[model samples]
Target: MPLYVWLACGLYWMNGMATVVLGSVLPLAVQHLHTTYVFGSDLVFLQFVGYWIGVPLSSMAVRRTGYRGAIVASSAITALASAGFTAWPKPLPYLVCSLANGIGMALMQATVSTSLIEWFPARRAVIMSRTEAAFGLGCVLGPLFASACIAAGRWQVAFALVAAAAAALAVVGAFTPMAARDSREGPRDAHTDAIHLANRRDRALVLALFMLCVLIYVGLESCVNNFLPAVFVEHFGLPATTASVAVSAFWAAMVAGRMATGWIARKLPYRPYLILAALGTLCTTVVLAATRSVVLGYVECVWLGLFMSGIYVVTLVFANHAFPDLTGLVTRLVTFFAGLGGATLPYAFGWTLAKTGSQWADVALALFAAVLFGVVGWTGWVTKRKSRSPSERVHAAG
Candidate 1:
C-alpha cells in the first residue's frame, strides 16, 4: 500500500467518525434542540437523501477531479458541515448541514472505495476488511465520544473537533498518492469503471446482488440499531441503560464481524460468505423474536451485529470483482442501493414495532434475508453460468 493509502484511511476514519457521531446523537440532539423525535429521524432521512442523491454523481466528480481532489472536496465539505452544526440556528440549518455532510461523505466513500480496492489487489478482502474495521471503530466510538463532549457542556466544541479532524485529514490526503487511473489504461476496477454500474461481467447478477445486499444489510442494521433498544426495554423488561448496552454491543460485534468477513472473503468467494452471514443473521433475528430472557435477548442482538457486518461490503467487493474494470461505477450503484436500504428500512421496522409486537422486527429481518438470499443465489448462478463460456461472459457484460 502507498503512504497515500494509509493517509486516505486516516481521513476516512475521521470522516466516518463524525458521520457516526451525528447519526447516533440524534435523540440527544432532538432533546437539546427542543424538537420532536420526528426531527431526530428526519435528520437521518435527509442525510441519506443527500447520500443516495450523490452516489451516482460523485463517481463522476472523482473521475473528473481525480481521487485526491474528490477526497479533499469531501473532507472539506464534511468538516464545514460539522462546524455548521454548532453555529446553525435552527432545525433547518441542522438539516442542511446534514445534507452537506451526507453529500461529502458519499463522495469520500466512493473515492476511498475506488482507491483502496486498487491498492491491495492480492489482499482485497483483508485490506477492505481493515478499512471497514476502521469504520466500525468510528461507529463504536462516535456516540461515546460525543456523549463525553456533550457532558463537557459545549456541544459546539464537539462539532469543532470533527471539523479539525476533517481539515487535518484533507491535508494528509492531498499529499497522498491517488493511484490515478486514466481511461483506456487501467482496467475497469482501476479506472472510471466503478462508476459504470451497468457494465459488470454479469450485469443481471450484479444488479440482483447489489439490490439484495443493500436492502438486507442496511435494513437489518437500521432496524436493530434504531429500534431494538425499545424492544429490549419493553419485551425483555430491561432498563433503558441496559437496553442501550444492547445497541452498543451490536455495533461492536458488527466491527468484529466485519474484521472476520474480510478475513473470510480473502479465501472464500463473497457469494457463499455472504450467504453464510445472511443465514446467521436470519437465525439470530428469529431467536430475537422468541427470546423472553432479558440478558439472552441482548446477547442475541450481539449475534445480530456479528452477522450484520461485512455483508454490504462483500456486495461492493464482489461487485467490483464482477466489473473489475469499472469498480467505481459498480461501487456507487451498489452503495446507492445499500444507502437507500439503510434509509428506508428503519422506518419500516419502526412501523412494524409500533403496529405489532416486537416480533414484527423478526418479520422484517426475515423479509430482508429472504430477498438477499434470492438475489445472491440468482446472481451467483448467472455469474457461474457465464464464466463457463468466454462468449457468454463477454456478451452478458456487454
Candidate 2:
C-alpha cells in the first residue's frame, strides 16, 4: 500500500469517529443542553444538510485545489467547528457545530472515495471494502471513547478530542505528497465507454436505481448508529454508559464483516452479494423488532451491522464497473443521495421515537429494510437484463 492509501485510510478512520461522536454523546448532550430528543434529531438533520451541501462543493474544491488542498481545508473546518462544542455549550451553537462537522466529513468522504477509485481502478472492490473497514474500525472505537468521556462526567471532551484529531490530520494532509491529477486519473476503456453511451436510457435508469439504493442504505445506517443507543436506554432500561456499548458491538461486527467482504466480494458476483446482504438486513431488522432481551438486542445489533456492512462499498464498486468513465460524477451523485438519506431518515426516526415510542420505531426500521431488499432485487434484475442485450453480448465477446 502507498503512503497516500494509508493517509486516506487514516482520514476515513477519523471520519468514522467524527461521524459517530454526536450519536455517542447525544443522550448525555440532550441532558446537558436541557433539551429534548427532538432537538437532538434536528441537530442530526442539520448536520446531514451540511453533508447534502458539501458533496457537490467537494467536487468544486477538488477542481480548484486538488485532493490535498481539499482534504486540508476540510480538516481545518472540522477541527474549528468541533472545538466550538466546548466553547458554547448552547443548543444553537451545538447545531452549528454539527452542521459544520457534517460538511467537513462529507467533503473528506467524497475526496477520499474519488481519489482511491481513480488510483486503483482494477482493485476497487477490495480497496473500497478495506477502506470502509477502516471506517468501521473507527466507528467501533468512537462509542467506547465517548463512553469513557461520559463515564468521567465530561461528555464535552469527546468533541474536544475529535477536534484535536482533526487538527493533527490537517497537519498530516499539509505535509503529505499527493499524486498529481493526471497520474491519478484512470484510463477510460473505449469499449466500455461505447457500450454505456450507446444505451443512454439504460445507463440513466441504472444510475437512478443505484442512487436510490444509496439513499435508503445510508439512511438506514445513520438511523441505526444514531438511535440504537437511545433504544437501549429507553426501551431496554440500560444506562447511558452501557447503551454506548451496543454501538461498539455493532461497529465491531461491521469491521469484521467488511474485512471479510473485501476478499469475498472479489469472488461473489455483485448481484448475489447485494441481494443476500439486503435479505440478511431485512431478517436482522425483523429479529430486532421482536426481541425484548437486552442480550439479544446487543447480539442483534452485531448481526445487523454485519449484514449491512458491505452494501455501500459493493454498490459503489458495482456502479463504477457499469460506468467506468464517470467515476467522479458517479461518486459525487451517490454520496449526495447518501447525505440526503442520512439527513432525512434519522430525523424521521428520532421524531417517530419521540412521539410513538421504540416499538413503532423498530417497525419503521424493519419496513425500510424490506424496501431496501426490494430495491436491491430490482437493481440486480435491471443489471442482469441489460447485460443480456445484444450490444452487451457483443462487447463482452470483443
Candidate 3:
C-alpha cells in the first residue's frame, strides 16, 4: 500500500509501452525519417545496444544518487528522449533518441527490480507478478495507441503521449518518500555477501543456474513474441489482421496468467508451479509449431503466453531472495544478458529457418523448451542440496 508500490507499477507500465510502441509506428518512422525499413529497424538494434550500455550506468547511478534518485533521473531521460523522437523525426537524431530511451528503460527495470525487495519483503513474488502484469497490460495497450494515432494521421502523437506519461511519472517519483541508504532495510554489504558465498560453495553454482535460466528464458520468450505473427502469416496463410489478433491474444493471456500466477504463488510452491508451467509451455509450443489450423494456433498461443507469463518475474523474485545483498547487481547482470538474447535470438531463429528451411523452427523451439526443463531440474537440485546443509538447517530451525 506504500506509494512506491503504485509508482513501481506505473514505471513498469510506461517501460512496457515504450518498448513496443516504436515497432508499432515503424512505418511512420521510415517515411518521416526517409530511411529504408531495413535500416529503420536498426533503431531497435541500437536501442538494445543502449540497454547494454545502461547496465554499468545504472550501477553507477544507484551508487551516486540512490535507488529513488536513479528512478527519477532515468524516467526524466526517457521522457526527454521520447519527446525528442517526435521533435526531430530524421533518422540520425531518431537513432540517438532511441538509444537514450533504451538506457532509461533498462535503468527503470533495474531500479524497480531492486526496490521491490525492500518495498514488499513479505510478498515479493506476488507483487513482482502484479508489476509484470502491469507490463503486459501496457503491451496490450501500446499497439492500440499507435494504431489510433496512425489512423488519425498523427503518428507523432503516440510519441508525445509516451513522453508526457514518462514525465508525469518522473515528477511523481521525485515527490514520493523513499528509504535512505542507511535504512535497516538495506541489503547486506558486499564484503559480507562475498564471505557467505565463499563459505557456501554451492552459492556460486546457484547464481550461475539463475543466470542461465534468465538467458534462455528471455531468448525463448522474445523469439516467440516477435516471430509468432510472421509464423502465422507465412505458414498458416492467415491475414495480417488475423496474425495481429493472435499476437494480441498472446499478450492478453500473459496479463491474465500473471494475475493467476500471483494467486497461485499464495498457495503453491514456486518450484512445482514453475515445473507445471514449463511442461505446459513445452506442449503448447510443440503443438503451435506442428499445427496449421488458425484456431488451434490461436489456442496454442494463449496457452503459451499463460505459461510464459510466470517465468521472468518468478526468476527475478528467486534471485532477490537468494542474493538479497546483490539484487541490484545480479538483476543488472541477468537483464543485461537478457537484452543480448532479445537482440540475438530472433536473428538466430531467422537464420536457422533461412539456412535449414522452416521445418527447423519447431526443432529450435522444442530444443529451447527442453533446455527450460533442464534448467528447472538443475534449480530444484541445487535448492535441495542447499537445504541439506548445516547452515540451511539452522536457518530452517529458526
Regions of model 2 farther than 4 Å from truth: 180-197, 389-398
Residues 190-224 of candidate 2 have per-residue lDDT tens digits of: 22222233567878889999999999999999998
110-208: candidate 1 lDDT, tens digit per residue: 778777776555455666776777777666665556656656655455577778888888887777666643223221221111222334444764566
TM-score of each: 0.81, 0.94, 0.83
Better of 1 and 3 by lDDT: 3
Position 27, candidate 3: lDDT? 45
What lDDT is obtained when candidate 2 is compared to the true structure? 0.86
**Superposed Cα deviation of residue 324, candidate 1 (Å):** 2.9
Which sections of candidate 1 miss by over 4 Å?
34-36, 149-161, 180-202, 225-244, 350-363, 390-398
Range of the 10 consecutive residues with the lowest summed lDDT in candidate 1 = 186-195
Q: TM-score of predicted model 3?
A: 0.83
